[model samples]
Each structure stands twice: as C-alpha cells, then as structure tokens.
Target chain A: MSTTEMTVHAFTRMLERHGADASRWPERQAAERLVVRDAKARQLLEEARGLEDLLRASLPVPNPTAARMRADVRGRLSTGPSQQLIDWFDRGPLWRPLMAALLPLGLGFVLGLGFPEPAADDDLIAAVSLLAFDQGTYLDESLNASVEGGEYAP
Target chain B: MARVQARDSEALEHLMVRHGGALHSYLYRMNPNPSDVDELGQEAFLRVWQHAGRWRPERARFSTWLFRIGHNLCIDRHRKYRWIAPIKTDETVETAEPTSLRRAPDQAFEEEQRRQAVRRAVAELPERQRSALLLCQFHGMSNQQVADILEISLAAVESLLARARRALKEQLVQFINTDQATQ
Candidate 1:
C-alpha cells in the first residue's frame, strides 16, 4: 500500500480547483499536477478529464433544431381546454372527484349522529342483518338436535 | 409559480430558449437515445406546468428548480428502467441528425470515436456519481448548484463526482491501451 494514495477529498479539491471554470485552463492544469503526483490517482483524473473534454467537444455546438420543443412549449402555452384537461389529469387519478366523494361521505357521517336515520340501501348493514338471522337459525337447530339426542333434553 | 404561472408564456418561452440547449445536452449525454432525451425533457416541463403554483422565487432560481426537476426525472427514469447501454466506441449514434457544422473528415471520425468512448464511460458509472459529474463537468454547473439540483450535501456531490471521474479514467485508460495493443 503506497502511503501517498490521495484521499477522495484531495482529488475533489483538485477537481474544484481546476474545474471551477470551463474556459479556464488552470483547473485542467491543476488536475494534471495531481495526476503527476500520484500515479494511479493521476491516471484516473486524466481519464476523467479526457471524458470531460469529449463531452465538451462532442456537445452539438450548433444549437439542435428545437421545432418540436418549441411547438411543445407553444402548444402547452396556448389558452385552451387541452392544457386545462392535461393539467387536471396530471393531478393524478381523479383526485378531485375522489375528494368530492369523500366529502359527502364525511358529511353523511357527521349528519348521521344528529339526524333521524334515513332508509338507504347499505350493503354492509344488509349483510350484518342477514348474518344475525343465520346465526339465530343455527342456534335453534343446534338446540333442537340436542333435545332429540337427549343430551340436554331436561 | 411566483409570477410566471400559466399566464407567463413569455417567461416560459424565455426559459425554454435560454436553458433548453443545456438541458437537452444533459439529457442527451445521460441517455444515448434522442427519443429518450426528448421524452424526458418534455416530461420535466410537464412537471413544471403541473407545479407552476409551487415555484418559489425566494428559495431557488427558476432555472435551478427547472434543472433539479430535470435531474430528478432522469435519475428516476434510469432507475425505473436501465436505458443507458455500456459505453463503447463502436456503438452507433442514433436519434440526432448530424449537426450542420462540418469538420475535416479524419478529425470528425476521430472526434466521433472519442465521444462514443466517453459516453460509454459515463454510462458505466454509478448513477449518482455520473449525474453529479455531468452536472458539474459537462453542464458547467457549480458545486453549490449541483448540490442544490441533486438535493445532496456539497460534500456528497464532491465525493460522487470524484468517484465518477476515477471510474471514467480507468475505463478510458483500458480503452486506449487496448486500442494501442490492437494497432
């Protein structure tokens, strides 16, 4: 293990120093210095710099055609129901309708406590009523069966 | 939102015109496919439209927030599905028509090859490291701005970039050395 392995911080400082300005040569020069000091570290920084240069150089210098992008922006900006519809849908999964439904349910719950019970087709309440009837019938049958068996005839 | 809500078409257009190139370039570098770049760029703006009411002038600049949105969308898209392929010199460039700017034939060939190599190296880096490196080195964002965009501590941004740079160097060296050997 070489005692001279530059810490990550040191390498970062080198990047910050040299990479501060795109036009400035010092950042690259500083990076080059660090490369010289530590062979492995230098190797890495050089490769990174090469990659940076490739990016800077390869970037399509001539502005890319933005006709589509411009159309997109313009389409979005134009005052119309389309943007409004998109904005509503982008709110995700009928949030307003869900919220509206919840509000009535919540109001009903609050109203339920004070107002006379109104007749309504509640599946939950109907299921519970049917369950009670079935249980009563089951108990009656069990009692009859027990009497017939003389297990609890007395 | 600030003052540039839906009504701020001029402001929105100004923003798109000013920062669109850099933003497009960032997307292009991250994803080799031009379709993915445009798709993600459009998605990022869609977010801007949805959240227009939430933009705060005091906390961040509009462009800063916009880039942050872009940075997040790219990261999310990468995680959701791996769009970035291995960085290789031989990979074909797609999606973009060649720019009008002409270079000497040999120089253009060499430049294209180098770019493909760099792209592969960048794509191979760990996600955060690659994002941070691109934001700072390629997009010319400051460390502070990069940190803000990435929503990471400055130290974390620096660390990720360092690691990214190291990984790229290793890849570039191997690529160069192998090319030399073959020659």
Candidate 2:
C-alpha cells in the first residue's frame, strides 16, 4: 500500500500495478534491486511473472467477432428500440396479433348471430324504398333532359 | 466520442470496432458464457449510444465511462438475475489456441490443459477480484482505470488484483512451473 517508499510491499504493489513486466515499472531499478536482494521480493516477482504469463498465454486473441459485433451494434443503434420492437414482431409468427386485432370483429359477428336483431318498421322500409324509387325517377328524368341538351353531351 | 455523443451511428460503429473486442474480452472474463458476452457487449455499446448525452468528457475518459456502464450492467444483471453463469472454461482454451503453439500433439494438448486450468482458477476468484484480474490481464487496463470502471478505490483494486493473482498463481503453480521449466 505504501507505494511512495521503496519497500518490499511497494515492490509487490508495483508488480500488481504493472504486472511482472519490470520494464514497465516506474521504479524499475529499485524493484529489480529488491528482486535481486530480497528473497520474498524475488518469490513475489516469480509468482507474479507466472500469473502474468499464464494470463497472457491464455488470453483470447482479438478475432473477427469484433467486426461482427460492431455490425450488430451498428444495426441495433440505427434501428433504435422502436425498430427493434417491430423486428421482434416480425420475428414472431404473424397470425397472433392479426387474430388479436380481429377478435373484436369476430366477437361482434358471433354476438350478432347469437342475439335476435330488432325488426325494422314496415313504414320505415316503405319510405326507404319510395325514396329510392323517386331518386331513380329523378335521375332518369335528368339524364333524359341532359341527353336532349347538346351542351351536356359526353 | 464527440461524434458518438452527437447521435452519429457511424461514430458509434467506429467506437464499437475500436473497443468492441476489448469489451467482449472483459465481458468474457466476467461471464465466460459466449451468449452472455455478446449480449453484454452489444448492450454496452447500445448504452453508450443511448446515454452519450450524459457523458461529461472532462469528468472521466470515454473508455472509463463506457466500461463503467458495462460494469454496472454486469452487476445489475447479476443482482437481478443471480449472476452470470459460471464459465464452462472448456471453450476459452480452444478459442485462444495460439497458432505458434501448433507443434507436437502431446505438448499442444498439455498447453491447452494448462490454459484451461488458468481459466478455471480465474473463474473461481471472487467477483471483484475476477473483474480486476480480467480487466487488467485481458485489456491491460491500469489499476486506476479498473478502479474507475469498478467504482472502487485504487487501493481496493490493487488488493483485488493481488489476491486474484495470488490465487491463480497457487492454483496454476504446476502449469507455471512447467512453463518456467520450458523457458
């Protein structure tokens, strides 16, 4: 912990800080002297070296997955969360939501079939038909009148 | 980083390409599960993009801030989901077989076994210790950077690294001895 002074503890701290690479230690001369002169320091240096070598030898190489992950991350960022939500839906089978949205319509159809509809009044039906026939007659008259007139001919 | 803060996808992609491998390596060291590493790495970059506005350049380095997000994510996921799955330790050895190490089958196999042991030893370390060791050994992050990322004091980081390395040294002593002998 006392990294300020040139002590054995400080030497080990340096080992932890910079690994066992003596070339990287700030107090390289002092530390090397400790390693040369102190058995405990030497042992600590040995252990640190062993651990460092194991770690370096075993560390995974930076492979092409970085590019793959970068592309993936780029896709994620560009698409944003909403796009991702839509993509999630796209990934799932399509029918589920379609059925959900149609559920109300289907329910209405089923309910209409189950319940009897109120009958329309006869007078209302007669008025509707009469109104339709009059509109048809009015249209027939207008068309005949238009055909007779040269200005409105197609 | 400035460009990333400006909501630039290209800048974000550049950052990903630059730091993605180190992030993946750090995540792998924390949680050796392949799927989890990819998920965490992607999520880290995603957060960087999403939260870029919040980063104060004068306060901390971009790399430190990015790693802080990752460290918090890992901790939160662990707390919420009962931690990253224990490493299989099987795949890392194979994934890292150096091409230079291609030699006699028996020696290669022995080397593979040694690396596997090292991974197992690292996996068994306590959470903070493992993080410290991995961030240092994997990416060569200094104690200060590790402290910033882990939000621990430098002394705490030093203690964690010392303990973790000590444990690894003890566990993998045989391999280390053979390695030393070979040298």
Candidate 3:
C-alpha cells in the first residue's frame, strides 16, 4: 500500500508485521497526514523500525555452557549422601516417628544380642539386693515391753 | 511426599535437565549479569527443593511454580545487588561460531555492533520501559504474558513498550545509520 494511503492502524499493523515499534511514529508527519493523521508519528515509527531492524539483524545469541552447567549442578548434588533414603521417608509420612524411635531400640537390641553377658550381670545384682534385704531382722519394741509386763502371750 | 522434594537426587537431576536451559535463558534475559543469572537460577532450584513439600497439585502447575520461583529470585537479586546493567550483546561469542557462516561476516559484524549500541540505549531508559522491551523483544513473550510477569495492567505494558520504542529510536538512529553505512 502507498504510504500516503495507509491508515494509522494499518501502518501500525505493518510495523508489527515488520517487528517495528508503532508508538514511535514521527509525530509531525503523522499528524499532518490526517488519513494516517500522524506524520511526526510516522517519522518516529520509521526510526523505531530502523532500530528494530538493527536489533533483530544483529542481536547476539548466547551459547550457554550447558555441559559445564550440568557438571556443576551434578557435582554439587552428588557430593552429598544419596537422597534415596530421605525420599523413602518422605513418601511414608507416618513412618517418620517409628523410624526415629527404632534407632535407640535397635541399638539396645543389637547390644543385648551382640554381647549377652552385661544384662546377665544386671539380673544377678538385682537378685542379690533382694536377698540381702529379706534376710535382715528388725526388733519390735512394743512386743518386748508387753512380754516384760507379762501382758502378752507367746 | 512431594515428588520433587521427596529428596530424589535422580529426580532433581531430571528436573534440571528438563528445565534448566529455558529457565536460565529467562533469567539471563531479565538480568544482564551472567554471574547473577547463574547464581539466581541455582538458588531458584534450591528453593524448589526446600519447599517442594508444600506443593499442592491443585494449586498450580510445576512449570508455573518454577517460573514464579525464578521470577522471585530475580526480584530479590534486583533488590539486593541492583543488577542494573542492560542486556549485553556478546558479538565475539555470537560471530565466532562456524555454524553461523550463513551470514556475511562484515554485515553480521556491523549489525551486531548496532545491536550492542541499541541495547545500551535501552538500558539507559526507565526501568519500566527497559522491562517492556526485554519481555517483548528479547524473550518474545506475548504482551499478556509480559504484563503478567511485570504484574501490571496490559494497557500499562503497552504504554511502557510505547515509550521504550520511542526512546530507542531517538537514541539509536545515529548508530543504526552508521552501522548500515558500514555494511
């Protein structure tokens, strides 16, 4: 379409198609041409169009260090213990408390099973303390006084 | 347990493999500094791991949450470090590639220089204007998406983009002509 014949909307649409900015149309000329009604606007548009051309034609592409990035991330992730156990714990929400409690119990069980003599010693100590207490005698002052006064039978 | 935070290293790796490039690209475009981009992207993933347990399937999609994490990291870094540099055109890296043999060297070089100049001009603009341009031009995000990312009204995005384009034209006309003449 002839530039003179183009509507503002049409011009903007054209600019969009060309990947140009529509708002920067030269205001003077765009205003003068009431049909496009924005001569200055057109000029701004033209300039913006030129800049957009430069941007698109010349914009540099970034080549990210994908391999290096992966290695960096992998190295950081792998240095720690495998998350597999943690993940299993996470999946079973109810098992957390049980898992926590089992550690002490398991240790105790292993000690009992692994070395049996210490628990046996503890049992012997308990029996000896009980026997010592049972074999001891206590004097009864009230009984002795009654026997002395002859007020109590044998 | 949340699938991601279930602490599965293999799963974490898979997520990284799947989304790392795109996320990095988005963050890199938003923040001009390469160092900040690298750090922020990793930080975002770390946050994902930390908060994965709270992820509800019904609330949002994984990609959306991921993007939100990345976007938030960018904002936090912006506040902390004020990463104010404009998008830099690394022509050396761009033109050094033999695969890019498709374009004539002289023309490509001049064009790249022009773009670098324009990028600097855009950087000098107001934050809103620069943001609009980055979203629209560099990332090719739709206007609606740009608005969403910026947390502004669509009309506001349009206005910012408008002002941005005007400023760019006024600033880069001379550079554009010089580059074109060289070509």
Candidate 4:
C-alpha cells in the first residue's frame, strides 16, 4: 500500500478500536486533522459516528435522583459489626493469615475431641473372646450330632 | 475513602452523590428492570461503605473500584435470576411515539424500529461483551479501565468490544444502510 493508503488504513483501525471520537484516539491531534482533510477517512469517521448514535439512542434514560438508593445503602451501612468484620477480614493483614493458619488445626482438634478413640486392649480382647466362643460352640455341636448318630464309634 | 473508613457519613454522602448516578445508570443498563437496578446499586454502595478501609488507591482508581463492585453485583444478580427478566422496550416505544407523531410518520416508525432492534441486539450480546461495550462507550472508560473493572486483560477487553461492535453492526446493518441512504 502507498503511504497515504497505509495511513488511512491505520486511521480506520484506530476508529474501530476507539469509537467515533477522535479525541479519545491515541494518535490524538494528527489523526483528527487527517480525518478533517481526507474525504474517505471522514466518511469512515461518519460511519463510526452512526454506530455510536445508534448505541446512544438505544440506551434508556436512567433515573437521575439517587436519594432512595443512597438511603437504602446507608441503612444497610448503619447496621452492626458485620461490615467492620468484613473490612477487618479484607484489610487486616495479620489476623487473616493467622486465622488461615489456625483453621485446619482448629478443625482437627475439634474432630479429635468429638470422636475419642476406644482402649486398644479392650477392643482386641472382645474380638478374640467372641471368636473363641463361636469356635467352641461349633465343635461341641458337631461332636454331639456325630455321637448321637454313632458315626464316631471309637 | 479514608474519611468513610473513619465513619464519616458526610464523606460517604459526598462519594455517593458523585458516583451514585453513574453506578445506577450502569446497573440499569446491565439489567433494564428499575427495581433490580435500585437493589443492585444499593448493594454496590453498601459494599463500598463496608469495604472503604480496604480501598487501596495504588490498586485502582476509586471509580474503577466502585464500578467493579457494581459489575460484580450485576453478574451475581444475572446468575441468580439467570437473566429471566426481559428488556423493558415497550415503555420506551410508547414514550417515543408521542414525540415522534410531530415528525414524519415513516421516519419516526423506522427510527423506533431501529431503536428496538438495537436494544434487542445489545441485550443478546454475551455478558462480558455487553459489559465491555457499555463501560467503554457509555461510561466513557478507557480500555484499560474496563480491563481493570472486569478483571480481564486489556487484549481481552479489546477483543470483547470488537466482537460486540461487529455483532451490533451486523444486526443493525439494514437500518444503518437505510439511515445513511436517507442522510
């Protein structure tokens, strides 16, 4: 592309990047002057203006008075220490990290206290005794049945 | 902000007066419902009041920080409601009709139709793109400020805006051509 063509292309790209307003464009005063001088660039700028007009036209006019909104927000702000606590959490440097470090340890301590372990020796003895009793009962019953049927003569 | 952190109601009120209208306008654009806009605006400010102590000027400008709060509230409300609320275009059309009666009938009708079409197109844009466009165009924020508000990179903001403008132009191409032809 020729130098002029390249400049126009760059200007068009700038228009697309930053809407119709040449003032907001990074190239600033030079591009504004170019748009004024160059017919094609001016047309492109007009097209951008049209799009911006459409955008603005479509927007609803918002309520200007914020009295009600301000009152409501202020009411909420007047409440107790929750906001203070949140601010502390957000802005307090030492407390937050300290809490973060203590959270898991606190949770583990609570869980440990809630579910205490049973005595290991008592638990083992109960299981062994139960197993021995079941085995003896099974052997006695088998012998009695065999004797009654005379299957174990000796 | 320091005064607000110090619990000065006057400082808070001043900040509210300065920024409240823009915040409300932003929320209204995000959600066309007035009630929702009011609630969200209040919530955003309440947060600013609550978190005033946390405002670090080195991080962002006050407006950027405040808009971020409003944007997050809007996003939360959108997620909670799943954007079930319809855009309130009927009232706008009705209001526009009375004034347009004094103008040429055909031109007025076309203008109204184009306005509705543009509103619908904007409402249909992806949330991020819509936010980017609204912040950039309507709020007069720079792309960098939009990036900061949306918590995205500048390139992402630019891309969202490009896609948004492209979609809007495509949607309104016929209206645009007719408008230019008439001009």
Q: Which candidate is the best by TM-score?
A: 4
Q: Candidate 4: where are CA atoms >4 Å away?
A: A1-6, A33-39, A80-113, A118-154, B84-86, B90-109
Error of 3 at A106 (Å): 43
Weakest 10 consecutive residues of candidate 3 chain A by summed lDDT: A22-31
TM-score of chain A of each: 0.35, 0.40, 0.28, 0.56
What DockQ score does model 2 reach against the true complex?
0.19
The C-alpha stretches of model 3 lying farther than 4 A from their native spots are A1-49, A74-154, B1-12, B52-65, B86-92, B96-113, B175-183
Ten-residue stretch with the least lDDT total in model 1 chain B: B87-96
List candidate 2 segments past 4 Å from native. Answer: A1-10, A16-18, A23-26, A38-40, A61-64, A78-154, B89-101
* Angstrom error at residue A119, model 4: 8.1
Better of 2 and 3 by TM-score: 2
Question: Which of the numbered candidates is closest to the native, going by highest DockQ?
Answer: 4
Q: Return the interface RMSD of the candidates, in order shown, one decimal each.
A: 5.1, 5.7, 7.2, 4.9
lDDT of 3 by residue, B4-88 (tens): 6768766766777777776776677667677777767776676677688877768655655676677766766665555576777
By lDDT, the candidates rank as 4, 2, 1, 3
lDDT of 4: 0.80
| Tens digit per residue, CA lDDT, model 1, A16-122 | 43453425333454444556777776554544455565456544433444567867767765648876666554433445546656898999889889875556557
Each candidate's root-mean-square deviation in Å? 9.5, 15.0, 14.0, 6.5
lDDT of 2 by residue, A1-154 (tens): 3244378988876886678876667788778777788999988887777778778777564443877787777677667678876744443245545666799999999998997555667678999999999999999999888889865767
Q: Which CAPRI category fits model 2? A: incorrect
Q: Which stretches of candidate 1 lie over 4 Å from their true place?
A: A1-13, A16-51, A58-62, A78-154, B1-3, B79-82, B85-113, B174-183
Give residue A39's lDDT in candidate 2 (0 to 100).
94
Instruction: State which docking tier applies to candidate 1.
Output: incorrect
**Evaluation by TM-score, superior candidate among 2 and 4:** 4
